[model samples]
Target: MDNEFYNAFASPISVTQNALLKNETGTTQKPPKLMDIDDYNGWSERFGNWVEAYHLDAWDHTEVQYFRPLGSDRKPIPIRELSDEEKKKYKNEKLMVSLLQ
Candidate 1:
């Protein structure tokens, strides 16, 4: 599913911490969402002009990225410390007691 999603979008649109309100004084803004654009081809052409105007790359450039795989209510998965010998003797991993039983 993850692979299929990535292949389709070729990019992941992360939820912004703070949405842009307006272009008021001393207010910075992120680019608009794909759905926000009414015209794809027209926007792409204009976007190319924008990139050139700002001296930016025509292609999408990604840097350090992080993704949350679980819901906000979901508890984080725990990691256990292992000894050197224990690390060397890795075995099949069991997730939960129900699965194990």
Candidate 2:
């Protein structure tokens, strides 16, 4: 009983530790940052390649349009009620926005 309790508690701590440490596994070089209009062309090409290297399906995420599920009354349906595909798109949209920032 004690072993089970300790394992359950330790699992999350170990996972968090691994997540924090995983950054060291990658190259020290970071993806290109957009500085200004003069650098936009170079930055866009480099950043697009960088994003593609890291995320194979990233372009799909960029191209998809998210249409909110609407109820009969025309109000948006609750997010919790979204279909699995919609939920994935919703999550990807937030991720893309974060990356753009």
Best by TM-score: 2
Deviating ranges (above 4 Å) for candidate 1: 1-33, 36-38, 57-101
For candidate 2, list the clashing residue pairs, or say none.
none
Against the true structure, what is each candidate's TM-score?
0.23, 0.59
lDDT of 1 by residue, 8-94 (tens): 655333222223222111122223233344666654565444433442322222121222233366753223444443332222122
- Model 2 lDDT tens row, 30-77: 455665679678777866776667653544577766667789999998
* Runs of candidate 2 exceeding 4 Å displacement: 1-31, 56-58
Model 2, TM vs. native: 0.59
Error of 1 at 66 (Å): 23
lDDT on C-alpha atoms for all candidate structures: 0.33, 0.67
Q: Root-mean-square deviation of each candidate, in angstroms?
A: 21.6, 11.9
